[model samples]
Target: MSTRLQSTNIPSIHVVIPGIESLKTSLESISHDTKFEHEKDMMFFRQRGKILIDAMFDYHPIHLMALFLNPRTRKMKQCTNSQRQSCLEYIKQEMIMFDAFDSDTQS
Candidate 1:
């Protein structure tokens, strides 16, 4: 497990996010010898990873905007129409708020 997470790069989100479903499937299919001393711990890890990946499907719109705007995920095939709209609105509101702040600071 330590070997699996040795590398971290933000740009890898483009590759990782798109393959989450397949990774979840692989996690769900994991099986170890029942007699192993740490079998239960291994199973727990698999279950927890699956749960987190599944929850990513319906994550907050703002959280998803990063995926949507990423060059490698611009198609946003994973997101529903409503999620896209929510992200758009969220960005617009944030832009307006930031503009107001910028003007205030300038004054």
Candidate 2:
């Protein structure tokens, strides 16, 4: 991860968002794991999974914006229409602030 960050000219939000979604999906799919020999261990695993999933959902706006900005993911094929709209609005707001900052700098 450090190597990739150093290699990129800018922060790679586009790449990070997809990788996060992939991990979240994988954890969501884990209904059962026979490798766990005891119920307590299984419970612990599920609890941790739930925490991670909640964290991912909490930061979903960041993920959504990254997806919307990425050319390859701009279509947001995996997202609902409402989510796409939310991202669009977020971007518009950011751009407005940026424009204002640019104008201020010119003075």
Candidate 3:
């Protein structure tokens, strides 16, 4: 009788967040395998990125914003009705520049 031993190599992916809790949370959210096929999961990450972008604009935290907006993170999806309304209010309050641009262009 002959015996064979098999070995498998798994590559590691690192996402570095500033705090340990955040790092742990991020790790918990993702899979080790690259094949994350769920469309809803992908959309969630994208929405998260948009939220981070908005936070950055409000707080002026460029690095955190950049990390969130990274293409590797994910593409954003349409927000739910409540989230959309909240975001609209936030934009009106904090993103007057964008609103002004829209208004000027429409005239």
Cα lDDT computed for each candidate against the true fold? 0.69, 0.71, 0.43
Displacement of the residue 5 alpha carbon in candidate 2, Å: 7.3
TM-score, ranked from best to worst: 2, 1, 3
Judged by lDDT against the true structure, how good is candidate 1?
0.69
lDDT score of residue 34 within candidate 2: 75
Q: What is the lDDT of residue 60 in candidate 3?
A: 24
Instruction: Give one digit per residue, the lDDT tens place, for model 3 in 1-95.
Output: 01111223431111222232243345346455766678568668756865665455332233333334446532212223553355445546656
The better-scoring model by TM-score among 1 and 3 is 1
Query: Distance (Å) between predicted and true CA of 35, model 2?
Result: 10
Task: Let me know the TM-score candidate 2 reaches against the reference structure.
Answer: 0.57
Tens digits of per-residue lDDT for model 2, 6-61: 56677676555556556556655644657666856666776698687766655457
Q: Model 1: runs farther than 4 Å from truth?
A: 1-7, 11-58
For model 1 the local lDDT of residue 95 reads 90
lDDT of 1 by residue, 1-88 (tens): 2232244743444444446645776888856557788878888999998888787664655556776777767777766788678878
Provide the TM-score for each candidate, comma-separated.
0.54, 0.57, 0.22
- Superposing all C-alpha atoms, what RMSD in Å does each candidate have to the true structure? 6.3, 4.3, 17.1
